[model samples]
Target: MDRQTRSLLAHADHPIAAPLDDDSVGRLLTRAVVRDDARVLDLGCGSAAWLIRALGQRPGVTAAGVDVSAEALERARRAAEEAGVDGRLTLHRGEAAAFEAPHPFEAVLSVGATHAFGGLLPTLDAALRHLAPGGTVLVGDAYWEREPSRWARETLGEYEDLAGTVEKVTAEGWTPVYAHLSTRHELDDYEWNWTGSLSRWALDHPEHPDSAEALRAAARHRDEWLHGYRESFGFVCMALRRTTDT
Candidate 1:
């Protein structure tokens, strides 16, 4: 499937595009956006769901988002208009890693988008580039809850354990001010929603040219999650502050 097709199908049910519940998302944004008039930027923002929520929660905040997908950016623009925050929101179509903003932001978010910059640390580096001094960075990425099998490692890429992941961040001169570990229910719900939504789309649109491919992709993804990484994989989102220059 193409990037647009896969993105639309995967996010059909879970608009956040991460294994986070509504409450968790609210809490993380609350912690990250301390300033009422905070300027927030979300790199690899996809459909900019997080930015929309942030803007809604803090009416004084202005936000910007960067993503390579024109389709996703269009959806974000429509959603922002519906939410009545389009006036304060800006959407950019480009690579998040290389996006250049006119000014730095008080909060930079890269949740579930570390892969866009190669890895978690590189994602942080990109966030730092656009972050103001004393600003907060909200980043989310997967880790290994248990020892991963070879298949799991190959499929998901190698990840440190939760503690190691945090240590790496701290060693890079960041302090985790708040953290949320995705619960079992959240993880399983996300997986089910992803596969079920895509499968349903394919089933509902049998005559579409990409329906069969979408179905196969969904099935293959479901299988990979269940047998490849479900038991060992974990996701964590952290609100971090730069403790020292790195």
Candidate 2:
């Protein structure tokens, strides 16, 4: 998919009317186990909505966001200002993979962003590098179908391990990347938004054959997911606690 965040954000269904992805993000942010002075840096923080909301509502905390897109960075800055969080939040336009905080980070968050990593090592290495001692991490990512649905296996592209990076870090080996958070429950959290967003993408991208196909595949995939995997209450949530050792 294109890296332009506006294009990505424009079509996604948010739990709120604002720029947020869903209520799950807010819940995770609220439950972040951090002290008032804890420093945070959000990776791939598109528009910095998560950072803004967390810093805006929480007191005695400072947060910064990093992203590769200049446009998204600008939006994040503006969002911070609009939310009255400019004093507590900063945004940097840089590649998150290489970005580093000037100070040790008490917390690092990446929601719906780590899918960029196909392997677990790369993701854990990145996360562990930024984490401060005894810090907490909240990791929520896309749910991969136990078996790819018909349309998903066909037109939705490859069946990627969206949650693999988190799993490999915490459960598999290489000194877990922080503690495990509720990954299982968070997977279902995006169903409504994903379905609505993809449907919108299909309707708006009538001329873009690839997008049109992607949206179609998304629709079919959602139906299959609901029938095959979803619950009446929606998603599953995991809680991960970070360890002192690396």
Please tell me which predicted candidate would have the highest lDDT against the true structure.
Answer: 1
- Any idea what lDDT model 2 has? 0.60
RMSD in Å for all candidates = 0.9, 5.6
Each candidate: what lDDT?
0.94, 0.60
lDDT of 2 by residue, 160-192 (tens): 343554455556333333332334444454555
What lDDT tens digits, residue by residue, belong to model 1 across residues 1-246? 696768778888899999999999999999999999999999999999999999999999999999999999999999999999999999999999999999999999999999999999999989999899899999999999999999899878989999999999999999999999999999999999999999999999999999999999999999999988999999999999999744
Candidate 2 minimal-lDDT segment of 10 residues: 230-239
Q: Model 1: residues >4 Å from true position, as ranges?
A: none
lDDT measured at residue 102 in model 1 versus the true structure, 0 to 100: 98
Model 1, global lDDT: 0.94
